[model samples]
Target: MKLNLFFQLSAWCICLCFSPVLAQQNYRNNEDINKALRNLVNNHKSHASLKSLTKTLGGKDVWVLTLSNGKPEAHPAIVIAGGVSGNHLLGIELSVKMAERILTNYKSVLNQTTFYIFPNLSPDATAQYFGKLKYERVANAKKTDDDRDGSINEDGFEDLNNDKLITLIRVEDPTGDYMPLEEDPRIMVKANPQKGEKGTHKIFSEGIDNDKDGVFNEDGIGGVAFNKNLTYNYPYFKSGAGEHAVSELENRALLDFLYERWNIHSILTFGPSNNLSVPLKYNSDRANKRIITSILKKDEKLNKHISEIYNKITKTKDAPKSVTAGGGFFEWSYFHFGRHAMSTPAWWFPKFEGDSLVKAPKNRKANFLKWAEQEGIENTFVEWTSIKHPDFPNKKVEVGGIVPFIMDNPPYSKVDSIAIKHSEFIIEIAKIQPDLKLINLKTEDLGSNLTRITVDLYNKGLLPTHTEMGAKSKWLRKINVSLKLGKGQEVLSGKKRLVLGIIEEDSSKQLSWLIKGRGKLQIEATTPHAGKQSITINL
Candidate 1:
């Protein structure tokens, strides 16, 4: 409503790429790769166009990936975005594969929907994953004044040990806030006051403060972590979140793209959190394997209201440039675009409630090995090793965990399997969306002045026009039929025959009407809930 300033940079940045995937191989770093992607998008002007946007937080443009199939202005669209968050490369990778899908599976899928995929939103951050610097990379691959200390990216985490990685160090500092887990010593828990907390412990990042800003390595270079920097509940001037909404140039660019395209019926984001993999991730309490019933039981009205509110807030941008980046994009899709939306973490590590050991070993150390062995992700962790530190006389650090691979970067080898499972899920989901298709139509030739018209309507997607409960609650589009006899003559039914109910795909209803026609007549069968179709009948 405030002019949706988030998309202000939409016009200037047309960040482009090359037509061939091979061209991308030449580019190194996100900046180059993003440019190539934009060039490729630019080549497809007939089917699509590429737009780049810069946010207030990020200095550069975020490349908006888009593609169109079928007749323009008439077909439904599916917007696929991968790199919305820097950490969610899997989303971006899937998007790249989605391009492959266009060549292999697009023909089969093009009849019903068009897909627009932006493989990597933060190529700068994505590039860091492959380059020499695997860690310490954030979204934009740019520099930031994280602590707002007037020093731009003057400090950052470094691999002091020359071990080729930046790892967290838990030292025995007298002023440390973290302590080993009583249940599992390897795990560190924040000291809880109500539960009789201890007095000694502290935690330090991999390196010392370069800028010497009193705070140790607080400000680092990179664009905003978009998930935390949006307009809705946007932590204003908060750490991680930049000066304001749409702070990063890339975020604004994406918002601008959404504003220009209104046909996107639903919004989907590949980022740090998700509804499918983990529904209602965090409410007031943090519980593993969350149960909807438990969430509702905690506070029925509040949870329901939050669910509805969150869903609505996450959709798309209407004003195009008004979004505030991180929060702006989600708001634009849901509230602004006025459509359904979803966001998911590219990867996740499901934690068990209790540390269940496969066998009772004489002694157990706190580490992911036992659980990793059980779940088969043991390769992700590295054992603790001793190192000579500038600050500590002889300090030891564990350089790997589930966070490094499964949460941070998934094994490239697992991409194919993960993609297959996710693609299947995506396709299954596509089957459930509100899809309208013309099934059957029949006209009977009766005696003079008498003709029967029947039309069948089917919603192939998974969700019905309205949920069973939603329908009963009267939350649905109109479910009525309309007959257009001529230019000026039309008959509209008032009875709500749609039945506040749910109908699965392949299941349909036949609507028949007795009309008076001596010659050819135009009959239009309309179902506002599932779309409409028309034909000619004679009596």
Candidate 2:
């Protein structure tokens, strides 16, 4: 009996020793993500399928997972994207987890709506999260001269302290523009000369002048940031914006796929910019411009409504403040692609107080430090230690700051709950997708072979058939109402085919056709996004 107990103890120890190497609930690398996606597809083969939309220059596949119960082409769709900015690892995890949850528990939603989930658009850059030397990188694998110095990737980051991770490097100089924050000395704030404050220090990324170009890490490894390479509000000639909009293989492939998918009426992207917590304010001037750059008035209201729903579901308050920067996919989806677009980080650092219950710092980094300290999260911040630098020989140089990607992502254990809530929100949105139906059909015979047919095409769903921008762009297919008449039949008043534009929520379009026809006639109404309906009547 004693020998048996000893053997069991040894077996338990072996299992514990090998457990760390096994996959856990955490941010996944590219290989792990691929394996998980394949497993998910294989497990739910009937409703889910996986495929590569395109391949990056570095040979990483841009994978997409499609889910639907019925024919996806026959229903409205939502496009869920992650890794729009490569460093946002939480985006990728949230996207994957939401897909899994939807496939497992919320399979019923697939009956009405289709979902296209791009798990990671920037796979090459996201892979840096699992590299031997980890750092937050935004651009993809392609190499380019970002500094326009004619040398490609010549001035990349260097581990000045040899810590295997890139942090911030601070130099104490009299003519610098930064000063230590009063609340936390570990954090820095820009000097306010108007407030009688003087500049005393300069902050730079953790690196040295590799090219001796007077700048530190200006031309970094990688090129063409996925978020910045989009067409809408494309930053002309800007670094990481690429030579032109949609210039990269990934961008072109995604746009090409989107161009063909007329049923995609909504887009949900997990990225740096978020409108879920706080909806964007409507700008009438921007909306009325010939180019129409802003979110319209009514759509802003919808965004607010959805924001309330998101808050109610996630129970998130005091969300981190974020502004949607120009040249992002989030804006492009609404302004150009003409879909209801929603973007969120899905998780961020909750406000934290110390063991002494001190007030949270106002600065984001300082608040994060306090939170990390209270939670006892190790390796989140690097202590500022003085180091000799090649460029700043006489200045005091210290390499240290909050670790990259820590503030944007939460612990893996907390991600499952977040994913569940987002999945619920997505399902709710799907339930509200535009449902077109034929209502109040009437047919009256005036005389021999003479009939007047009238019908109202109603949008029974909460959202409009097409977005305001969509109606303006005319990119989405118009609502087509056709009357199939019998042989030797003709229409005297209205044309045989009717082309109508956007139909708002709970609204209907009254269509009348005075036709000189006999026998049974069929009237059909259809839009690529809103689905189809048909009715038959006799003359």
Q: Which candidate leads the pack in TM-score?
A: 2
For model 1, residues 1-539, the per-residue Cα lDDT tens digits are: 44555455443343322334344332234565555566555655545555555433334455555555545324455677776656556776666555545535544555455556666666666655665545645546446677877878777777665655555656665456666666556555667667877635556666775765546567766746665555555677766776777666666666666656534545566665444333332344432224211222222332243334333433211111112344534433443344444555544433333445444222223333444555575444444445565555554433322233234445555555555555544444444556565568777756655556677766666444443323332333444444546433222332213332345544666666666545555544333334445566554
Candidate 1 stretches with Cα past 4 Å from truth are 1-68, 141-143, 182-187, 192-199, 211-213, 278-336, 349-406, 437-460, 465-532
In the order shown, what is each candidate's alpha-carbon RMSD? 12.7, 2.4
Q: What is the C-alpha lDDT of each candidate?
A: 0.51, 0.87
Put down candidate 2 lDDT per residue, 1-539, tens digits, no spaces.
99999999999999898775565656888988899899999999999999898899989999889998868788889999999998898888888899999998899888888999999999988888888777888898889998888899999888888888899899999899999999898887899999999888999999988888788898988898899998888999888889899999999999998999999989999988789998888898888988878788878888898899889998887777765656799989998888888988888888775545587787888988888877888888888989999899998999998887788888787888888899999998998888889889888888876888788899998889987777878877889889898887898999888888889988998889888867778889888788888988877
Q: Pairing residues by index, what is the TM-score of model 1? A: 0.66
Q: Where does the lowest 10-residue lDDT sum fall in candidate 2?
A: 351-360
Model 2, position 221, has a per-residue lDDT of 85
Clashing pairs in 2: none
List TM-scores for all candidates, in order: 0.66, 0.94
Name the lDDT of candidate 1.
Answer: 0.51
- Weakest lDDT window of 10 consecutive positions for candidate 1: 314-323
